[model samples]
Each structure stands twice: as structure tokens, then as C-alpha cells.
Target: MNLKTAWIWGLVSAVLAAGALAAPAASAETLRICSDPDNLPYSKAEGAEHGLYVDLANLVAQKLGAQPRYVWWLSMNQRKALRNTILAGKCDAYFALPADKDYGTRGMKRTQAFLDVAYAVVAPPSFSFSRLADLKGKRIGVGFASTPQIVLAAQGGYTTVTYRTDAEILAALDKGEIDVAFMWGPAAGYDNLTRYHGRWRVTPVAGEHMDHQVAVAVPAKDAALLARIDAALTELRPQITALADKYGFPQGQPVAVGMAQVQAGPADVALVPTAAGGTPYGQPSPYRMMAVAAADPAAAGRELFNSTCSHCHSPNGASPIRARDLRRLKGKYGDDWLKEAKQTIEEGRPDAGMPTWGGTLKEDQINDILAFFKTIQNN
Candidate 1:
């Protein structure tokens, strides 16, 4: 089986195992959860205590005959803080940790995941992305140590601006400083919905690489505690989900990003004709400056499309993965599809893997791409 399929089954099996071992007929006791004080949608020391990890801690505490307590700490060096608090008996659990060895190798154990987080690309409503390639040349806002930065680094060509916090990233996004903001699912979703009043479109990237399972953290020696918490988590899954929704965690159908395409040599396409001079389709089209750029819109489109879009969305309308079919725009998109296509091209359907292009591509270039779409209209 593929790695994704394997991981899915593994999750199912793990859940089942936890369910079989859940604590029975329990009464509540006090359980301390070490969390970051300022981080919202994940943990917060202030009123309501509605973050996913905090809520999950409460649920686990209730299931295990415990009351929940807050232990505020900085998130910069999570491992050291966890060791000092949860491991040292200052707290019983550390809610919300990446379920990987790399996170806290020193002395921490993780329970089966109670939550799954994926990277989201937040953009203007006009943009709709269908794949990673769609993000090329665009400026994206990302958080330090966040998954988006990792993904962006792997896919070069895009200009990624890093920030220390989600608030910084959001500010940049709102100020039109960045075309797209790569953010954590819970924090980004809540802020966008509450602060931005649902003005932004936040889409989650599917697949294992982008998927993050959040689990409870405990001391390394506490295997029994781990197993019991895992069981409690199995019983508290429903409650956990409810809290996630209450705090504005994004839980929607997975959107398919553009498919991965084979690499091709850069095309020498000219930008669409303009009053001053011509430009190229892709960013910094060298040919346009060199006077060797394609003069016709179709040729320019063909060249740029081959070099960039074709990498994921195939030149002949096929792709390595199941991304949008370029040839089928006419069949799939009607008059409404034009607007949809424009939105997809500009903002990108990030949930599906498309990156926003609002600041990256010129209006004329986007029009040229649209015109090219007319030529390859799927039957």
C-alpha cells in the first residue's frame, strides 16, 4: 500500500486499540496541562480556555476522573518546558504535541492523535489555487517553525516571508503585503473567521506530508499513563471534535490541489502586448527582455504554461496526480466558471493545493492565461 494508505490504516488501528483500553466508570480529578499562554486556538491562559489542546485536556481529565489545570509556558523551546512541568510532576499532561520523535526526543511520550492539522493557504476570495505550482512566483506569509515554511522551502521560486507569530502573518495578509499566508489550521481558521469575519478563504492541503496528528504529551517513563491517556482520548474523541468546532477549528472536506507534473525546460514566452511594451506569462520572463519572447498570445501562453503550469497540470491536460484538468475548463466551468477560474487563478483554492497569484501575475498575464484556457477548452 502507499504511505498515505498505510498511515490512514495505522490511525484507524491505533484508535481501535485505544478504545479497547479506555478508563471505565471514572470520576474527575485535577489534571494539569502545560500550554503556551498567548497562542490561541491551540492554548491560552485567559478566559474561556477554548483552544483545542486545552479543551482536549479538559475532556481527558473528565474521562480519567480528573479536573483540568493550566500551566502556562513559552512555546519557543517546547521540550525543555514540558520536561520541567509535565515530566517533573508540575503538570500531569502536555496537551497538543506533534506525534513525531523529532519534537521532544529527550523525555516525552505521545498518545494516539486526537486531532489532525494540515497546512492552509489563506488568500483573497478572488484567488483559487489547485496545486503547489500555482504558488510559484507569489509572495507567501509563513510562521517560523511552522509547516508552511518547510513546504515552501522544498518548492523553490516562490518568495516566502517569515514571521514570528500568526498575528504578524495575518497583519501582513490584511495589509496586502503578501499574496498568501501559510498558517496552522486551528489558529488561522479561527482568526480568519472571527477577526477577518470570514473574508479569507483558508484551505487545507491533503496527503500525509501535510497532515499533522496532534497527541497528548507525557513523561517518557510514563508508559502506563500514556496508554491510559490514549484510552481516554479514544473515549473523548467526540468531545474533542465538539470543542474544535466551538473554537473555530476548520473541519471541512479535503480540497484537491493541482496534481504534480513532470519537469520541462523553461519556455520563451512573451508577455501579452501592452501600451508600453510586451511582458511574459511567468515571472521575470527573460525572453521578453531579450526580444526573443513569443509575439502571439497563444505562443506566449503555450510557452509559459509548459514551463510552469505544465509541471503539475500536464501540457496535454494530463498530470502525475489528480489536479484540475486544463483541457476541461469549458466542459466543467460555464459562464460561472470564468469567475471561478479567475478566482482560482488569482487567490488559488489553497485547500486544494492551488497558491494565490494576486500580487505575482500581472492582470494582462492572467488574462492571457484565461485566453489560453479558451483554446484548450475541454470537450
Candidate 2:
């Protein structure tokens, strides 16, 4: 070969090599997302149906010009799951956190809410539920230690049958054991579509703490990434809505149930007085304080547990992690489970990451937590 031709070929080879080397660097830009492996209608690890969060994550990653990499983590204890995964640098973002700024988001920044999630009333087509009063005299099914159960118990006059999960509640409703089931909207809707073939009517209900906005969360330092995610979410809003429909999420206007004023301490549940017309959606309702009366200890205890213990043990003691599942305490320890639990709470199980609450929490608070646990035991 001629010297000139040889030089030209070497230059061509060098350019190609450089391009090849640089190509992977650009392609290697991945959006690492942490999500629950088993949570359906939200996220899943494997299958044709990857759930709403997984699909949304993929769309966001595509918009960011990055590959999607998932860090599978069971989010039974949301705070702990966030601590172990996203805050621990295992992933770049966590899907579907409450968009409310006051939620337990100390070290993370959340994108604008892309979805509205709320508790829903699932019943047969003939049944109608426009307001809370409609629930009176009806056998309502609710998840044990759930918001619905707490609210119902506080309200009184409503006969609510408690179940461990939303699926159980649906099953009960199907068997004619309960007149209606009030549960999480997304789960109920997904189950209605998949398990029940969309036979039941899943209608979302509006009230305090009944509905919440959901968003993606990232580490606080990832301001640039957060902004990118916000833009992607905005651009993909239409797609997200379509995905929600595909997953059978309850859509359209929610039924407005008049607000209930729930107090954390010992007090009777009072109905929050409405204005001349009615309370607007997403706006705080007017309040008229009534005389305090005795409150349900179990209900009050649930509030405390969710705020404090849910970080590790999970909300309502329904931990998917076997070791931490408070529901199984009775089955595991037999008659002495309560005693064992009390001692454990008083003394820190440092080896297992359980902190001592003896000094941090009051005796009444401990009793309240224990009271809540007793109602949830899987005996």
C-alpha cells in the first residue's frame, strides 16, 4: 500500500475507535429508580405488566436520554425503604411518594404530582355511595388498622367489618359478607379489573387524608435531575393518564364525603362544619370545634404507630418482611406475644436495629401502640 493511503486508513480507524469509545459513555447515562418489586398497580419486578411506576420510570428515562435501571426494594416501610435505597445511594429516584412537602421527605426532593390516589368505595353496581351518611346502617368492609377503619370507628353508627388486606375485603364483598368495601382506590381498581373482571364499581371518595397526590422523589442534591424529571413528567402527563386507565385506576370526579375532624388525642370524632354552600376540593374545610369526648384508643394508637413505627414495622403493622411483620406476633409467640412485645419496646433490640422507646415515648403512647397491635395480630 502507498504511504498516503496507509495514513488515511489509520486516521479513519482512529476516528472510528474514538467514536465507539465515546458512544457507550453517552448510552451509559442511566436513571436508577427504586421501587417495590411486588407492589402491583404501582410497580412489579418481573412480568408483562410492570405496573404504573415502572412504565412511568421508563418513559421518564427515555425523555432524559438515559437507560432505566431498577433497584428492587419492598416498600412496606416506606421511610426505611427510602433510607436504605435512595438515601443510601442505591438508586437515583423513588417512584410514587406523596407529593405533599410536609410528608417525611427530609433529604429528598419530590417532583410535581403526576397522579391522584385516594380511598375508594367498591360495591356492586346497584349500590350507591355519594356521601359518608350513605355508609350508615350498611355493613362496610375495611382493612384492619387502615384509615377507613379509624375514620369509621371515630364516626360511630357505622358497622365496619375489618379485613387484613384490600383483597380480603373484596372477597368478603363478593361473598355477601359485607354490603360494601372501602379501600385504596388503585389496589381495589386493579383487583376489580384483574380478579373480578371489573364487575364492581370502584368510586373514589374525597375527605381529609382520604386523597393524596403522588410524585417521584430524588435525592435533594440532584436538583438538576429533579428538574429534568419534572419536565419529563409534565411532557408525559397524557401518557401517564393513559397508563392509569390501562391499569384500571379509578378515574373521574371523586364523591365528596363531608370532612371529619379527627383528633390524635382522646376526643370524640366531630364533623367539620361546612360553609354556606360546601367545602371545595383540595381546600381546607371550615372548622367548628365541639366538646372533646372519649376517643377510640385503637384508632388513636393507629395514628401514633403510622407516624413512628411505620418507618420500620410498616403501616398498620402489615410488614411484608417476615421478620418485622407485626401481624404474625401472636402466631409466632403464642399467648406471651404481648408481654414479649412490651419488653422489646421498652428495651432496644440494638442488634436488630430496633430502638428503645421507653424514654422517647410516653407510657400511654406505648399502651396505645400495643392496643393497635392487638387488633392486627394474625391469630
* Model number with the top lDDT: 2
Off by over 4 Å in 1: 1-28, 137-139, 143-154, 159-165, 206-211, 253-379
Worst 10 residues of 1 by lDDT: 277-286
lDDT of 2 at 101: 76
Tens digit per residue, CA lDDT, model 2, 281-352:
121222332332136667667765764566467778899999889999999999999899988988979899
Give model 2's TM-score versus the native structure. Answer: 0.66
Residue-pair clashes per prediction, in order, are 32, 0
lDDT of 1 by residue, 1-379 (tens): 4323332333444455468765433233446677777667777767655466766666576566554556777665554666668767776688667775555546678888777666677888788766776777887887643445534543446667766567878988999878988776666788887798888877777643445566788878878878889999888778877877777776766554421321121333112212221111000111121122235665555544543455347674456464567766666766676677888888987798776766666666666677677787756
lDDT of each: 0.62, 0.75
TM per candidate: 0.55, 0.66
